[model samples]
Target: MGQLERATEATLARGARLVHAHPRTLASVVALSLACFGAAAYGIAQTAPDASDLPRRLVTEIVAHEDLPSQLEALAGHELQLYRSEQTRAGDGAESLLARMGLVDAEAAAFVRRDPLARKLIEGRAGKLVRAAATPAGQLEELTARYAPANADLAGTHFDRLSITRGADGRFTARIATVPLATSVRLGSGTIRSSLFAASDESGIPDAVAVQMAEAFSVDIDFHRELRRGDTFSVVYETLTADGEPITWNHAAGRMLAAEFVNKGEAYSAVWFKDESGRGGFYGLDGKSKRRAFLASPMEFSRVTSGFAMRMHPILNQWRAHKGVDYGAPSGTPVRAVAQGIVKFAGRQNGYGNVVEVEHGNGKSTLYAHLSRIDVRQGQRIDQGVRVGAVGATGWATGPHLHFEFKVHGEQVNPLAIAKSSEAIELSPAERQRFAGVAQQIRGQLDAALTVGATVAE
Candidate 1:
């Protein structure tokens, strides 16, 4: 017989002898094979170092449950792969992620961008990926990258493939990771009779978030007298990393929900948008433009109780034109940040109360007056809605309301009409595909999460 035939006969005879001697071993092997059929790899981690043309990676999360009454361990297996570059960023990344999903590069990214949460994942950027087999706990896996670095001669970085996969099951592949693509937080509602701030105190929105929400909508509404009762809001934002912390929110983002002035007869609803051209604006419920050429009222819910015209000045009784607007509210009524900018002046002024002036770029500066206190300092960077101070009759004010002013460069202008605007966050054409792929993958995770209880931890 040929060498192959002789070897086959010998192997079969040995197996038959062993099976006759130990019947239980054969039964156990057959049972295990059926249990883990397509879910298990035979020579996976045990592949010889010299072997090439390796099989594709394993995809599965091995979720363990302590409560299930079965004696056999429950197997929660799902496959996933995420690549980070045009070459590697497929599977879980966009073009790269889609490529990993066994799709053509172009198709993967298109799918991801079609969803909102997926577009957000590319923005959230944890910068690493996960691929698992036989486990639900995210296991760390080794990965590859194309770091197109410029050098003296070479114009692009080369690809470096590395791996760090987990052996057994648990969360995190044994490697460094990128942040997840999206983030969310739950909040409760509250009622207010006076202002949004008072109502926010009763809601779960921290003062910081409350301030930002007001600032985001300041272009359209006045918060001081506008907020009455049952006003509500929700946001979906960026995730950033300062040190080691996984950030939950970044201001360069979009918000999905907001409501206000229901206590009054008037009601307003809007979705904030930063368009692809980098212009930020507001859209009303009908998607009609709520944005005037210039944004009206630097702070929302704060009104133009005092207008830009001739008046008997409150402190200096003279028929002089009031160059700005006065926002009438109670003392210690926390003042809002009118727009995204830097603090240029945060101290006493000639006749203004504990004033805080902000430079909103493009030569625009807004001033807040009649403060019981100042919360920001000179040269400090603050956002649009952060509280700069509490209102009080400080400098030359007859009452608690704040004297607000808007200026262009050094010249004074009406605070109701700021014309220049800031840009919004967007994805480039190349990035769009990548963004979409990531969203699709996350949708898969979301689907899985919905099917399986997160109470799996329970």
Candidate 2:
């Protein structure tokens, strides 16, 4: 029929002829195959026995049932305590807060309103974690609230505990104590679809951690302008908790331990390291300090309302050169000093509104205009991140915004360019060896973070 079929048939014919020519040999081969199959059958029959031939045994035991009357009596004697937790909200009064926690004790509410220590629950800032133990009848038995301590210096390391308990005399007693906070490491990863905050929110990262991430990479990336869609980041940070519950106030996020940001397909990494002097800062895995002479932006994160370019002035309605970048944020937003410097001028000027001028060494000076209020006075030394003022619409501004300007020898220059060109400090030789170990550990953490990001992307 075809060349292939004809070839196959010829081969088969040759094979048949060979078989016929070696009839005795073929018979011997068949006998050996039969013998091997018989041996295999016999071995299988000997190894496997019938189910009925295998050993069999019957076992039985009696299970005793508990007496129902005795069980009911035990349960009746057990105290039925209900536990509930709620967060304090703004405008929450004693009655409202107790009601939210499913508590309905008039005496408890009256004590909360009258007692000085219990009044602290509703006073001051809100968002305190409140846990209450109540009876089956919805009467509050004990109440405890945890929040940031009154002392700002101890806010990061301790929390204020306000506890109220019902005494044997049917009276409520309240006490306040400061307790040390616990620290825990956390890992998070996200892909940028819109903004860093949005990504961080989707990844369940706290706002404080996101702010720290932005600040850690402030010198390398201008979060206001450089963030791109599809960019990804992985972060390792410390979270402070009170009695195992995460704290919510006082910027309770501990410190950013390590982070890796892939912006525009280029990856940047940072790790926190403390020197023997107990001074700590974020450094690249290569041991290069991330701190620069100047930060790219005065605010942690904000959108640019105006750039350094010529545009129609909102007040003048005519084309004029805009010397500084305008950051659009709510009024009273703290404006930080971009570099450590001495306050040269901290007063209002014509068309500049309330302003603070800082004289950084090397003929470099920076100005923050349209400030609602100035915190630093003239001739005061301020650190790079120290708050100089707050955003405002004072002077010639139309809306609330921070107008930031950088000057080189009395001439205005682009602040972003100047910050990017600033030199970065390198680790000392003595610290390099220790830093290498830290970097190695951080590198593994980053790799794990990358895997987490990839999983989230999927």
Q: Return the TM-score for each candidate structure.
A: 0.35, 0.80
Among these predictions, the greatest TM-score belongs to 2
Off by over 4 Å in 1: 1-269, 272-299, 419-458
Residue by residue across 298-400, what tens digits does model 2's lDDT show? 9988889999999899999999999999999999999999999999999999999999999999999999999999999999999989999999999999999
Worst 10 residues of 2 by lDDT: 247-256
The lDDT, on a scale of 0 to 1, for candidate 1 is 0.53
How far residue 65's Cα lies from its native spot in candidate 2, in Å, is: 6.6
Predicted structure with the largest lDDT when compared to the true one = 2
In order, the Cα lDDT scores of the candidates are: 0.53, 0.92
Candidate 2: segments with Cα more than 4 A from true spot: 1-80, 252-254, 450-458
